[model samples]
Target: MRRPHPASRPAPQLRIKPPRQLIAESGADLEGHGLRRTMGLFQLVCFGVGAIVGTGIFVGLSDSVAKAGPAVVLSFALAAVTCVFTAFSFAELGGAIPVSGSSYSFAYATLGERTAFLVGWCLLLEYGVSVSAVAVGWSQYLNELLNSLVGWQLPDALSAGPGDGGVVNLPAVVVILLAATLLVRGVRESARATAAMAVLKIGILLLFLAIAFTAFQAGHLSPFATHGAGGVTAGASLAFFSYIGFDAITTAGEEVKNPRKNVPIAIMICIGLVTLLYCAVAVAAIGGLGADAVGDKPAALSLIVNQVTDSTVGGGVIAFGAVVAIASVVLAVMYGQTRILMSMSRDGLVPRVFERVSPKTATPAVNTWIVALVFAVPAAFASLDAVVNLTTIGTLAVMAVVNVAVVALRRSEPELKRSFRVPLYPASPILGVGFCLYLMYGTGWATWLQFAAFLVVGSLVYACYGRSRSRLVAPAAPGA
Candidate 1:
């Protein structure tokens, strides 16, 4: 008896839609037609620094130092190496696509519709959580500054967020709302403000390195890898959060003139500049303040500067710089988040609320406020580690997708008129994937669990609303 094979049955029809076909159906265009390309290499570097040099440097330096001792320098280098690979992939994709949504747009073009949705979802965690985290970190430094200036400080209960021992993070919330207001005004204004802050931050970091180096003690270098190579790697993973925003320069590709040449140049310049700055600071701090001392204080660099010089002047300068720096971090990250949401709305992943631009401001007013409120509250009181960890995981996930996108695009669309191609093709992207994966593993299991929950919730939302409402799935009437 010949049994009928299961292969004889017809293949089931997929509820899934073709990705490219859907992209063609969506009326929204990715490229900006007439936007100004006013950003020069200097401005672009500032933009990258504005996004990258945030509370992470001001607050996270101590944490990393504590984890890896003098080896923290190696950690920064490890993180920078990982970032360089990802940055190259980003440069190639951003130049080719030049779209509003950075990774989300890339994933849609190469991966598929569902993968695109997932990428956007992960970004929400990256950008949204990070904004809140940065805001909260700002509040701490602000309080520190106030105490140093006056004899008094804000009540701890009022200063902190829900998890940090306070009922609410009033300062963080206020800063977020203020940033939202500024964003509602315009991108140019926001960028200008951010640029000023970036300058102050770089100045502060340089000053710290210079002063710390004056007190450098070679003896502190003894027992360098006290925590071993594994600990140093773990610290590097944590330090990766500091490098989060360099790719943001690419997100502005459509707005830049000569994006092909300028965008790639900006990414390399920005990464190189930041890495040099971080290395200088790390080496100086470890030399001046024993790695053991570095771990004992929250504001390690500032504390070391004060201890080395025994001057209130150093602390004042560092605190003021931190205030300016963190403010810019909030502004830049919120800008990135709103833009991501706008891109998603255009593609029908989320509600049209994300797409609504205020006639008064020409920005996404409602979306800005919504994002501000969501991030502000938690940022006020939660531990910086928790928020930063979430951001790192989300960013790693996005980077992984980008690595795949680079390879897939090459094989699938070999002649897509890419202004920049990631040199060494398969090898570069594979290295990028490996770097991001290693960092992703560094995040503890708790963060992974939270990330998983976020994805599951996002998937449900897409299934219930986004899938059906997708502009590409149900094409509009010809004359509607």
Candidate 2:
């Protein structure tokens, strides 16, 4: 066979498709989905809260407190402000696109297939490690709850992962499987379960607040900014972890009822609820327990509850709540992972099996199970410390891209209907991207290198498979 000239060779799939094409595909293909759009504002808000309120408040507060002392409360405010700019960008994009895949979908419609592939790849790391990390946190609290309530605890061999001197973190795997099973059942049931858990979780935090304030001494907050402005910004960077779940709302657009209007509503509602809850919890814990005492504690919230009440029962209840709260995180993270894969697969970026939704459950059965198994290994055997940092990087990067997507779509498709438009035109998204980049810089260069390596691998995969199989062909198929 004669060798083809370089110019004669078919170019890779890099051309951007018209936004209308993607919109039309959605209109036609979505009608055939097993995915029912039954998720309302409350369920959406619950999903965001369920995902947001747990990991940071329970375990991450210790590190934040150590960095910024009582000023960690201000740290939450700083993070929230950063989140607000990004949230506006998300609201605008989610309202206009009203599709799945989150930034990946939005980026595809605006930035081109290559950039979307990279965004989806980043999300894989973010969601997978996040689920595993939440599972690990749940296991720790579950063990604490057992010891606190029943005066019994699991052996290190069964309770701790290898990173902490154990054969396997069996509890982590169990929790991941449980969350996956719930997700496989369907979104409505999952949302309802999430709402119930959110209520219980909020109740526990409220109880802690009430108890903490009884013993609150202004003296505890003396010398509040121990480490100064640098420390506060560092704490904000770390505290930003809790805000990742608001983006989880963007992933549920297709399943949300009235997504164009409701997605933005849910995003803002979730942001407000999360910011308030986080600030309250941080202040209460620090006010009652003192920053020095709580700074190094692993189960810091429970310890604060114990110190305030001077009873194991009080601590035990808090521990029980921590378990439920982290369980919700596991559920939301796993749910986000499966949905992103479904979106990518539908675009022919992954195996088609991923996009297959179960008619019986109206969920992506195989995708959910696969996501559970993938994260369960890490939860059971690996140290998630390094992997967890990658989620922060991935999240910041994706949020920046989503902001840019809003700008690009505005310029490219001016006539397109947008239920929510970002205020202040280019400035909002520009500021959103700028803030995200600032945070990404704080995540350290090591994480940046890892993110770059991740994109390199994803690009290789795209060249080998995604470009060849991508459904952006003539005579567009449903959701192509």
Candidate 3:
């Protein structure tokens, strides 16, 4: 066999990084990443729920209900099951891979550098657009709350953003900026805010369920399967976006206390908790308000409250919850985006700027700001659904890839210490990959176009930069 000439040799970064090497890099102490390990299981759980239960439930539920009618309850169930399978993959990887890049980091450990770049690129889409989507949801609910409490509404020019019509989404921009400011402060502070928001939003959903049950009518469920199987499938695919944030727990692996144990447990617990809340809310909305009413209602939860009590005061509470939910989601998604970028930077896939952490805050301050800046543009200018489908498509693709990585690692790294393991082995990971692909196909063609375009641009960036600056290439080497 002839070796390639040195002149024709591919760069070292183009080679696969060994799992043990990735693990050793992650296990380093005071590596100057400036990230602090401080989050406990409670905070990790809060981050998961805070990210999982937001815009999808608050602002986007009507979209799902409209797509599937009363069958949206079933849609939520299907989406939840799909998420559970993926969550197991995440659990095992999170326990085994000590990096903070979430799936991006996992892919690097199990797959290779180029694959890791793709995963991180997809994550950038998933997290950044998710933050925008959640912020838009917050704006919608905030408008509802203002109308209910003070009898005022911001006209579409100010409330709606680019694709939605206005020059900019002022409210969404405001909230994104607020979350970025909080992130600039520190991670612990961010977790505290997340916990508070989680508590309030969960209470709000429980309250909606209680009030909705009083007005629940069996007749409203007459045509539970309105759109039949097809609509339910579409709804499930869109509903999958809600669970996008659960895997975010893995991104905090570097910051969480006892990450090997805590990260996996948090991922499962967060998925389970969010699933129950989603199902209950769906049942309450459909049974009490009927599918048609739920679809027509802009503020579904608030409308349910007003229907039960026939008063704006009750609507106010539900609207408040939406506000809190959207705010928390934006914060958590931003956190995930920054951590992934930081991890990529540590590996030299991107500029080192994103990896630098603020010594004072013990957070990736610059990276956090960059993320907020990146998403704020879309939040301010783009329409709500403009980026929603793109987010889902990218996420499903990454999840599918992560599932593949799980199977790959099972055979290649059997001796690695893992605090959590995927039960049922091959079946679970295979199902995870299947579920993600099924949902990806469910996403519309336009979304696939957007996703493809984004990856093309990402590849260009990588070819120009990652090909040269990757950490795998030593500075002393002449051909580095």
Model 1, runs deviating above 4 Å? 1-41, 476-480
Rank list by TM-score:
3, 2, 1
Off by over 4 Å in 3: 1-14, 28-32, 475-480
Give the Cα-based TM-score of candidate 2 against the true structure: 0.94
Task: Tell me how many residue pairs clash in candidate 3.
Answer: 2
lDDT of each: 0.79, 0.85, 0.85
Where model 2 places Cα greater than 4 Å from the true spot, the runs are 1-14, 28-32, 474-480
Which predicted model would earn the best TM-score?
A: 3
TM-score of 3: 0.95
For model 3, how does the per-residue alpha-carbon lDDT over 154-230 read when each residue is reduced to its tens digit? 99898888577777789998999999999999988999999989988899899989999999998887788889888
lDDT of 2 by residue, 26-81 (tens): 55226424578878988889998998888778877887888899999988898888
Q: What is the C-alpha RMSD of each candidate to the true structure, in Å?
A: 3.1, 3.1, 3.1
On lDDT, the leading prediction is: 3
How high a TM-score does candidate 1 get? 0.92
Per-residue error (Å), model 3, residue 52: 0.8
Better of 2 and 3 by TM-score: 3
Q: Kindly report which residue pairs in candidate 1 clash with one another.
A: 161-380, 161-381
Better of 1 and 3 by lDDT: 3
